[model samples]
Target chain A: MKGMTIIVKTISSWVKLLIFLFGIYIVLFGHLTPGGGFAGGVIIASSYVLLMLAFGREFVEKNLSLTASSRLDCVGALMFVAIALVGMFYGAASFFWNFIHQQYLADRATEFKLVSAGIIPLCNIAIGLKVGASLFLVIFALSVFCNDFRCKGSARELM
Target chain B: MSDIPLVLPAFVCIPLVAAFLLPILGSFGRKGRVVATALANLAALSLLAMSIASTNQFSVYNVGRWSIPLGINMVLDGFSALFLITVNLVSSAALLFSVRYMEQYTAKPKYLSLFMLMVAGMNGVVLTGDLFNLFVFLEVASIASYALVGFGCDDEQLEASFKYMVLGEVGSMFILLAIGLVYGATGMLNMAYISKAIQNNPTNVVLCFALALFIAGFGLKAALVPFHAWLPDAHSSAPAPISAMLSGILIKVLGVYALVRTIFSIFGISTTVGTLLVVLGVVNMVTGAFLAIGQGDLKRLLAYSSISQVGYIFLGIGLGGALLAAGASPVWASLAILGGLFHLLNHAVSKSLLFLTSGSVEMAAGTRQLDQLGGLAEKLPLTRASCAVASASIVGIPPFGGFWSKLILVIAAIGAGVYWAAALIVAVSVCTLIMYLKVHRYVFLGELSETRQQIKESRGSMAVAMICLACLCVFLGLVFLAPALRAELLEPAAKVLCDGVGYADKIMEFSKDMIVCAD
Candidate 1:
């Protein structure tokens, strides 16, 4: 499929970065805010989705290839597991133990800070990465059928 | 034993990690499939090991070091341990079988990944101590199975998947609505806390409504008679190994196990619900058996048999519950529950073996219809033998796993003074025998069809998986004869159910350590 109109392309280009940054903010500050990995990840994925719509699939593929996103999805999930494993190994702690909370980060002053909440924020980042990549892949895979949908127009669009 | 608690989360975590990584690994060309297979096998094997090692061990792991009733926890009691063993054992065998069976299909890695996710979900369902988390895990297993059911992308597969998905989602909706009502009534999502709340105020109308919803929801999942429309299509349409997984253990874990846990442990079993289960069990037994005798499709017959067998398990459990509600001797109640749980384990092994044999037949003969396939005893010796073994077991022939369990059910019924139930058990066994005889006569003993002359038996991993489960079907009856093994493997599980709402106290006691650790 060809790219959308120049105006749509230009506008999406400028707005995509803001959406990406906001998603990162949501992920990083997830421990203290309403938006955590899941919400933030969807937001980030939407930015890429917007890029796909405005600049076309080829452009988005060039920027973030399917293989890379797929790899990132695995890496993010592995990172979460690693954090939990590390917690287990370091202290003989239970699964998902908050090592940071029991140690240096215990002070009340650090409770609401970005660097606080032990491994929770780290977990949020990992989950955000995985969810974003997964959503993108789903969107990308679905979009591969766009040609069929286009040929059949509104009739097959419901499929 | 102390380390067992720490290992509990690994059951859920390892599978999740493997599932996540499989797709990326699969992208690495020819070597990727091998890598995915090795990784999945390792994950499955380790889970099997842990479940076995943890047979007698009991503990609960608190998430994020949060105390129970606050943060989510994973429990490893007798009941969950038995389920863990069955799930992981079947999973490992199915994964082994899939390595060969799935080669005929494309996207092997995606298949393995989804398989791992399903394992993770079932493990989570078996282990989680919180209500909402159980729901979450149940959905995980359900969605993965839904996808796997339609994995072939054939018209029939897609249609079957849609049917299964719609019904499954409706079941899930009932469960979620029940959870919401439960939360509203008790103001808790943790199962133990909810149990504690219900025990303190045992007369809430909303909780009773929630109990009704739970039965309907989990019953739909278990595919009890009235709600069993989706099983035959979905089971028969999916790939063979997956059909084995879905029909063998998935239904048990997602349906019967969940239903049993909620009914007995969470809501606390009473005579009313007990009688309800007994009635449902009898109806499903009669209906499922009659339906199975009519099916020409091998997998469809096994699916109906699954419903029928599940009815037996429910009957035993329900009789136990009724006896308990009547304040009868604890011995009779325990014996009934034991009979039920033993049947559950027996059926899991035999049914999966049956499905795998069906897969073998399908793989070799290129057809599942009993009318089209014949004389597999000559062409596919291994499959025929294993099929015979599993068939004998399912028919409750003596010395096999199914017979001992069925005998226990009869004895339990007689001991409970429920003579009619005992007679029903014997009658069902006879019907089950006739069905299997038909299977043996038509599929294995008759003359081979002309077109199927060139058919070949499934070799290597598929044969190995079938052989292993068939051996289990033959030898599992020893658990009844061996007192020590029974005490270690099955007794603890039966005890948990027998304790009823007292599970709340036991879990709370285990959580005390976590609370101390947290401080």
Candidate 2:
């Protein structure tokens, strides 16, 4: 498969970065705002999907391989679990125990602050990475297997 | 007992951590396979130990130290412990069997990961005290099973997966809708609060409607008679250990157990609901047995038998519910429920062994068709012996686990003066006997087929897994014969159901000590 027309490709290239930025913003501010890991992860996945749409499957595969995405997905989940376990280590707290805002942590995070809410931000970030990579991998594998979308002609022929 | 509830969440966590870790470990080369297998085995064993250790202990763990009725809780009552033992025992065995059984399939890591996820989901379902949380965990398990059913990627497996997914999703929708209705009416999602609300206003039309929807949804999930179109196909097409999991405990946990818990403990049992269950049980028993008699595929036959056995368990429970509703002796009700719960344990052990035996036969004979398999008694001695043991148990032969449970059910039904149900129970035992005889006559008794002459018995983990379950099948009956074990394990579970709506009261009482306000 080949890349799309110059107009579509150029616009997508600039828009993809902005979309990625927006997704990060949503994930980082998830504790204070409406969008959290799941929604933000989806937005991030869509940006990659957009990139794949403009540049074709090959270009994206070159940037991020399947294995790397899979590894990242696993790492993200492990990080979340690790955070939960860390809470347990502190005074034998419950599973998913949030201890980040405890009196032990030098200065406590105040209300409405990004660093507040104990482990919510960390959990959101882990879930964001996991859901994003997972969705991207799903799309990537599906696009790779999808024969109908494969080009039978060069980019110039259809345009 | 005070500290026991702290381990409740670990039941969900351990398998989850293993699930995510397996894939990462598998990304390494050949050495990763050994490491993943070791990790999976270790996880399964530890879970089984924890389940056994928590037997007969009840406590409620508030999530994140939040107070109950305000935050979600994990309840470790007798009912949960009974099902937890069944789930973890069968899952660990299945995982052991899969270590070798799945060698032929690519991506062993992914398979184990999915298996762990399914276990985690099931454990979560059994342990959760919230309604919506049940739905979420149910989804996790259902999605994993759907993926597993299609893991083979054959046309038949794919078709079966699609059909299972559609029906499963529909079932899930009904459950969610019911949950929504309950929440709308009661303004609470905690089961204890809902039960309390129902106790206060016992005759709401919407609550009744929600109860009806729950029956339909959970009945479909359980695959009782009318909702059983997917079981035969999905169970037969999946890889064998997975089939064992699906047939063994998945349906029991998600379908039968969930439905019973909702009806009896949450909404409170009634004569109408009890009669409804009895009727459904009779229909399922008759239908599943008749269907099994006609199946040529070995695993398909066992799958159908699963439906029949589940019918027996439900019949016993329904009889108890009916007796309770009639304001009869609580002894009879408890006896009936004891029979039901015992039969649940019996079936979980025996049916999984049956499926595993079928897997062994399929693996060695290279076919699951009864007509094509022959004289496995000579070539596959261990499988043949274990299969016979499982068959005997399923058929309610004397001195085995199945016989004791069936006898209890029959006695309870007769004592309750439900003579027809008693007769049906006996008749179905005979039907089960005939079905297993057919399996024996066609698959293991006849002269070895020429093409399968070179077949050999399965070795290593698969053999060990089957033999372990087979031994349990023979000894599990002793649970009834032995007073101490029965008093500790089976009796407590029966008491939980006999107590009915009292379940909420107990949880509420326990909640006072465990509740911690989230800051």
Candidate 3:
């Protein structure tokens, strides 16, 4: 698809990084704050979508690519499962045990600290990556289909 | 605190990891398909082994090592175990069959991934002790099945998938609304806590409203008569192994098992709900069988037969619930539930076998149209035999799995003094017999058609899967015939439902350790 107005394109190119950084902030502070993995992920995805909107689909595709995004999606999911499974290697071998909290950070695991929540931040990061890639891919696929729908529609008109 | 059964999470974890890993491995080009197939099969086989090896016991596993109020719990009671075995058995057979069967389709890895996701979701649905988690898992499974039904991307497949999605989403919405109502009423998401709340004030109007919504929602998912519009098209249009999974286990787990769990364990079956279930059951059996008799497509016929057979299970359980509520002897009540549980297992085995045989027939003959196919008995001897065996079992012939379950249902009906329901059961069985007879006459027994003269039976993996399931169909009755096996498998599953709201007490007793842990 074609790019938007030059002004919109220029503005989005600069603003996208801010959106991405803000999404990362939300994901990191998810355990303490209102917006968490899913919400942050959507925000990050919108940043990529903003670039696609400004620079055209092909421009974004050249950089991120569908296959890369798909791979990232799978990687993100496996990462989350891996994090959960890591707890199984520790004391008592429960599926998602917070061994770090109990073993090393016991007395110091205070509220309002960045390191207090052992795995929640990691889980949030994984979830953010997955949701962001998945959403971008979905939107990209729809944009590709929009071309086909137009052709099909025109064919119907001719008939 | 009790030792957490680490194995409880494996049921959900293995399939999930396999699902994501398959696509990555599948991207390995030429060898990807082989790797994906082997990995998927390994996951399924391990699931079956785990289900079988896991003892029939009650325990709860907490997620993230959090206590009950903070994190979800996975409960492995008799009810969940029974479903776990059925889901894993059918999934293993279907996965093995798909090794060869999926060669007809592109995106083989994607298909396998979706299959595993569906399995994982169903396992989670059965294992979860929390209501919201059930909804989430239900969505995961439902979404995967929706994509699977239309995997072929054929015009008809797409149409069926869209219709299924719409109806399914509506059903899900109803469930969400009901869950919201339930939370608003009881201020709890854990099923045991909700049950405890209900027990304390059983006559709350809001809770009653939530109960009605739950029935409507879960009833739609289960595809009871009024809500089964999307089933035939979706089940018939999917690839054969997928059809097998859908007909065999998905509906049983997503629809029937969830509904029964909600009513018996969470809400505690009242006379009204029991009667409603019985009425729905009667309607489902009659409508499904009658509709099935007119179908020309083989897979469509089996799909309808699924709805009809699921009805027998509902009737059995509902009769038991009604009897228990009326304060009857516990023997007759447990007997009715036993019949239902047995029928559920019987249908899962026989119906999947039937679908697989139909798949093999389609693979060899290149058509599922009953009129276009004929006389495969001599040419495809093994498939013909498997088909005949499954058909007979479904028709409730003397020795197969379905016969014993149907017989139990009849005895239970008579015992419960529901003479009309007993009569309806027999009449529906006759209708089912007529339907399968039509299949036999048109598809297998007649003179060989010229176009199918070159058709050969399905070879290798597909053949082995069919053979195994066909054998299981015949031998499954041993669960009932062998007293010890019955005591182990079916009896305890029945008792879970028979115990009703006592499930709350059991879960509470186990989770009583959460308070101690929190300190």
- Which regions of candidate 2 fall more than 4 Å away from where they truly are? A104-109, A148-159, B515-519
Each model's TM-score?
0.96, 0.96, 0.96
- The interface RMSD value for candidate 2 stands at 5.7
Q: For candidate 1, lDDT tens digit of each residue in B13-72?
A: 989989988878898999987998899899999999988988877788887777767889
Tell me the tens digit of each residue's lDDT in model 1 across A33-140.
899999999999999999999998889999998789889988888899888887886664767777877766876788677888888999999999989998998898
Error of 3 at B79 (Å): 1.2
DockQ, all models? 0.58, 0.46, 0.47
Mark the regions of model 3 whose C-alpha exceeds 4 Å error after superposition. Answer: A5-9, A150-159, B1-4, B513-519
RMSD in angstroms, all models?
A: 2.6, 3.4, 2.9
Residue-level lDDT tens digits of model 2 in B160-208: 9999999999999999999999999999999999999999999999999
Clashes of 3: 0
Residue pair clashes in candidate 2: none
Model 1: residues >4 Å from true position, as ranges? Answer: A146-159, B513-519
Docking quality category of candidate 1 according to DockQ thresholds = medium
